[model samples]
Target: MRLISSSISLATAAALLSACATLPQGTSRDSTNTGLDVRTRYVGLTSDAEVAEILASPLGEEAAVRLALFNDHTLRARYDQLAITEADLRATGLLPVSDGARTPEAGIALPVLDIFLIPLRNKQGITIPERIEIEVTDHAVALIADVRRAWTRLAVAKQAHNLAKMSENIARAAEKVAVELADKGNLPADELVARKIAVANAEHAVIMAESERREAREDLAGLLGVDLMGDWFVHNADPATIPADLNAVDMQAVMDNSLALASSKAEVARVGASHGITDISSILPDIDLAVSAERDDHQWEVGPSIEMPVPVFNFDGPKREKAEADVRAAQYEYAHSLVVTANRAALLVRERDAAHKLVKLLNEQVTVAADQAVAASLRQYNAMQTGVFGLLAIRENAVEARRHQLQGWQRYRNAEVAVDAARAGVILPLKN
Candidate 1:
C-alpha cells in the first residue's frame, strides 16, 4: 500500500539521473562566478584590470602568464566547462518536476533495482563537479607554464639576435681591414678571401638569429593574445643564484595536488561507486509495482500488482564481473599515477637544483674568466703585443662564453618554471 505513495520519490530520482539530455545553451552568471572564484583561489588576481596593467608595459614572465589567463580563448572555454559541469550537478540535485495533471490510474514505474542505487548515483553526481573543478584548475596552471616557456624562448631569441649582430659587426670590420691590407700588398689574397667568407658566415648567422627571434616573438604573442605590431619587450634578467630547497618539500602533498594523480583518484572513486551499486543490484531481481482502478457495473475496484522478471537466462553475472574489473583497473591506474607523479616531482626538483648550480658556476667562474681574457687581449693589442687577428679571436671566445652563460640562464629559468609548475600540481617539460 505504501509502495504506491513512495513511487514518486523513486521516479523523481530516476528522472534526475537520466533526464536533461539537452541543457540550456550558454553559461549562467552564477557558473561564471564559481569558475572565477576557483581561479582567484589559485591565481590570486581578481580583475582584468590587473592583467591590463601588466600588459601596458614591458612583458615579464608573471605578466605574460596573467595576460594569457585573461586573454586566451581556449582557457575561457575551459572555464566554461567548469560552468557546464556545475549546471549538471545543480540540475541533478534539484530534480525538475512537471506540473501537468495525472489520471487516477496513472502511477510512476520505477525499476526496483534502481531504488537501491540512487544514493550511489547521487554521490557520483556530486563527485563529478568536484573533479571537473580540479581539472579546470589543472588547465589554468598548464597555461601558465606554457606562457612562461614562451617568454623564456623569446628572451633568449632576442639575446641571440643581439649577439649575432655584434658578431656581424666584428666580421665586417675585420674584412674591411683585410681589404685595405690586401690592396697595400701587406696581406695575402687568400687571407682576404677568408675574411670575406667569415663576413658571409656572420651574415648568415644574423639571418638565422633574426628568423629565430621572429618565430619566438610570434609564439609569445600568440600565447598572450597580443598584436605583434606593438613595441613590447621582455627583460633579460639573470636567473636566481640559489636553488629551491627540495628537502623541505612534502612528497605526499605534491602527489595529492598533482593533476594526473587527482584525475586518477577521481576515476577510482567513481568506478568504486558504480561497482558497489552493481554488486547489490546483481543479487536483486528487477521488480515493479503498478496501481490501477477499474470500474464495472457502476462499481470501482482498486488494486496493486507486483511484477518481477524471473532469472532463468540472465543473472547479472557478466555485469557484476565487468563492474569488479572496472574498479580494479581504476585502482591500478590511480596507483600508477601516484608513482609517476612522485617520480616526476623528484626529478624536476633535482633538475632545477642542477640548473641553478650550473648557472652559478658560469656566472661566477667561467664568465668572469672569459671577460678577463678579453680585456687582457684588448690591452695586448693596444700595446702592439698582439695582432688584430689575435684580439678578434679572443673577442670571439668571449662572445662564445657569453652565449654559454645566457644559455645556462635560459635553462635555469626554465627549470625553475617547471619546478614551480610541479609544485603547483601541473607537470611541464623543462626547456633545454
Candidate 2:
C-alpha cells in the first residue's frame, strides 16, 4: 500500500513539474541563441513604421540589413516553427487521462519504464528546437550577405555613373578644341567629325551608366522589402575595401560558428537519443504500476497492482532497426557538412586573393600605361609629330582602361564581401 502511494506521488510530481517548466519563446529574437554575423540591433521589430523611420534617414549597409531581418516574413515564419516543437515537448510530460465515471473501480496507471526514458525523450525534444534555431541563424546570415551585396552594387553604380559623366564632359571639351582647330584650317573635316563621334559615344556611355544605377537602386529596394515608390534614400557610401590579408580570417571561428554543422550535429544528437530510448525500451519489459480501489460484496478492497508485458512475441525489432538507421544517417550527414565547410572556406579565400591580385594589376599597370600613352600622344600632337586623330585615339584608350579599372575594383569589393559572408557560414551565389 505504501509503494502504491509512492508511485502515485511520483506521477503527481511529474505532472506538477511539467506545469512549472518554462518553454522557449516562439519568436526568433528570443529563441535564437546562435549569434548572427551582424549584431541584431533591431530584433523583434513590430511595425513597418520603424522601417519607414530608417528609410527616412540615409540608409547605410547595417540599417538595410536590420530592416530586412526585421521585415522578412519567411524568416519570421521559420522562427514560428519553435511553437510546434514546444507543444510536442509539453505533451511528453503529461500523463494519459481516463474517464473516471465509467467504472466504479478506479485506478492510476504509471509506466515504470518512463522514469528511465523521459530524460532521453526530453533531450531528443530539445534538439529539434536547437536545429530550428540554427536554421534561422543560417537564413539571417544569408540575408545579411544579400543586403551587403546589393549595397555594394548600388555604390559602384553611382561611382561608375559619375565617372562616365566626367568622361562625357572631357569629350565635349576636346570636341571644342577640334572645332577651334577646324576653324583655323589646322584640323581636317574628317578629324572634326571624328571628335563629334567621340562625344556621341561618351554620351551613350553616360546613358548606360545611369540606367545601371537605377536598376541597382531597384534591386536594393527589393531586398530591403520596401516599395521603390517612396522618397527613401540610400546613402552613396564607398564600397568596402579589398581585404589586405585573407590569413587574418579565423578558420576556427568559422568552424565553431557554422550553422550547417551545428544543425547537423543537433540532428545527430536527436536521432542518437531516439535510438537509445528505443533500444532500452526494446530490451526491458513494460512495467506499469497500477493502484486500484473497488467495492465488492459490500466491502472495500484496495491494493497496488503491477502490470508488465513479457517480450515473447515482439522485441521491437523493426523500431530498433529504424532508429539505428536514422542515427547512422545523421552521423553521415554531420561528417559531410564538416568537410564541405572546410573546403568552402578555403575556396572562398583563394578566390578573394585572386580578385585582389587582378584589381591591383589593373590599377598599377593597365591604367598607368594608358595614362602614359595619352600623355605621350598629347606631347607628340603639340610638337606636330602626330595628328589630332592620333591624340583622340590615345585618349579613348585611356577612357576604356579607366572603365575596366572601375569594374575590377567592383569585383574585388564583391570578392571581399563573399569571404566575409562565408566566414559567417553562408555562401553568396556568384553574381554575373
Candidate 3:
C-alpha cells in the first residue's frame, strides 16, 4: 500500500524542518539579552572573561539576571525545546502515512502479489504560527523569573547573614567582659548566667543564618544548572532604597503579557482550528482526496477516491468530545491564572509596600533609638554609672532591633521577586 499527500514530497518537508532548528525568536541570544537588560550581548569576552566579569564586579540584580539568561543550563534547554516544537510541527506537515520516511508512495504494488494499493484521499496539516507562539513566550518568561528569583534569594540571605555576624561579634565581646567580672567576684551570679546565655544564642543565630545563606546559594546554583562547589560572590543591593513606583505598575499590561493565560487561549485556538481536520478517516473531516491508477488484467484504469468513513455509530463523536473537553480544561486554567495571579501580584505589591514602611520605621526610629541607648549605656558603664551586665542587656536589645530590620528588608526583596513572577504570564513584546 502506498499512501501520501499529493501536494508536498518527503524531502521538501525534511528540508523545511531542518532549516528551522535554531532557537525561536524571543529565546535567541539577542532577544533574551534584550529582555533582561539594555546592553547588547557580550561578543568580545571569552567564556572565562565573562565569568570573571560577573565575578569581578559585584554582580548586581540586573547583571545577575543577564548572567542567568546567558549562562543558565535550563535556559539553553528551553531553546532546545523550541527546536523540538518546530520538529513536531514539521512532523505534522509531512506525509500522513507513518512509513513516509522509509518508503515513499510510488503507486508500485508488491512483486509477489502483483497488486497495487493507494489511499484515495490524503490530507496534510499545516501548522499555524500561533500554535507555538505561547510556548515561546512562556519559556522566555520562565527563564527570566527563575534567574531573578534565585538571585534575590541569595542576595537577601547574604544580607541577613552579615547582620548575624555583627550580632555574634557583639555578643562575644560582652561575654568576655562578663567572664572577667565573674572571676573578679564583681558580677552577680544571675547576670553572668544571662550573659553566657546571650552569647550562646547569638552564636546559634549566626550558625543558622550561615546555613540559610548557603541554602540560598545552592538554590541559585540549581537555577544556573551548576553545582555549588565553586566560590561565587554575589553583589548585594539595598532593595529598601530601590524605587519601585507602585503607580507605575501597568496592571493591564501585565495581564496582557501573561503567558499562562495566553497558552490556554492558544490551546483553545489550536483545538478549535484543528477540529475540522483531526480525524483522517472521515469524509467530512477534511476529506483526503487522492488519485489512483490500477491495471486489471492488462486494462489500465485511473480513478479518484476518498478515504471517508460512513456516518455510522461512531461518527467522530469521541474525537469531538475530547477536543471540547480539552478546550474546557484550558479555559479553566486560564481563568484561574488570570484571577488568581492578578490578585496575587496585587497582594505582593501591598506586602512590599508594607515592608518598605516597616523598614523605614526600623531604620529611622527603632534602630536609631536602640543605637542611642547602647551608646548611652556604654558611656555610663565607662563612668561606673551602669554595670557591665546592664550594657550587655541594652546591646542585646539593639541587636534584636537590627534583626527586625533585616527581616523587613528580606520580606521586601522576596515580595519583589514574587511580583516579577506574577507579571510573567502576561505577554511582553520581545524586541528583536
lDDT of each: 0.61, 0.58, 0.53
The TM-score obtained by model 2 is: 0.60
Kindly list the per-residue Cα lDDT of model 3 for residues 1-432, writing each as its tens digit.
323212211111111112222322332233233231111132122365675656666666655555554565543554455445544544555323222221212211111011101110111122424434444434544555556666767877788788888777877888798889889998898978887897799889989999988998988876654447766677774644745444445555444444554554445445544654343222222111235677879997664332322222233578767755654554455445556556655676677677767777887789899999999999998999997668877987887887787667766666655555444443222110
Model 2 alpha-carbon miss at residue 108, Å:
49
lDDT of 1 by residue, 81-147 (tens): 6446645555565433223311111111332122222331221222334554455545655677778
Question: What root-mean-square deviation over C-alphas does model 2 reach?
Answer: 19.6
Give the worst 10-residue stretch by lDDT in candidate 3: 112-121
TM-score of each: 0.70, 0.60, 0.63
Q: Poorest 10 consecutive residues of model 2 by lDDT? A: 4-13
Worst 10 residues of 1 by lDDT: 3-12
* lDDT of candidate 3 at residue 48, scale 0 to 100: 56
Which candidate's lDDT is highest?
1
Which number leads on TM-score?
1
Superposition TM-score, candidate 1 onto the true structure? 0.70
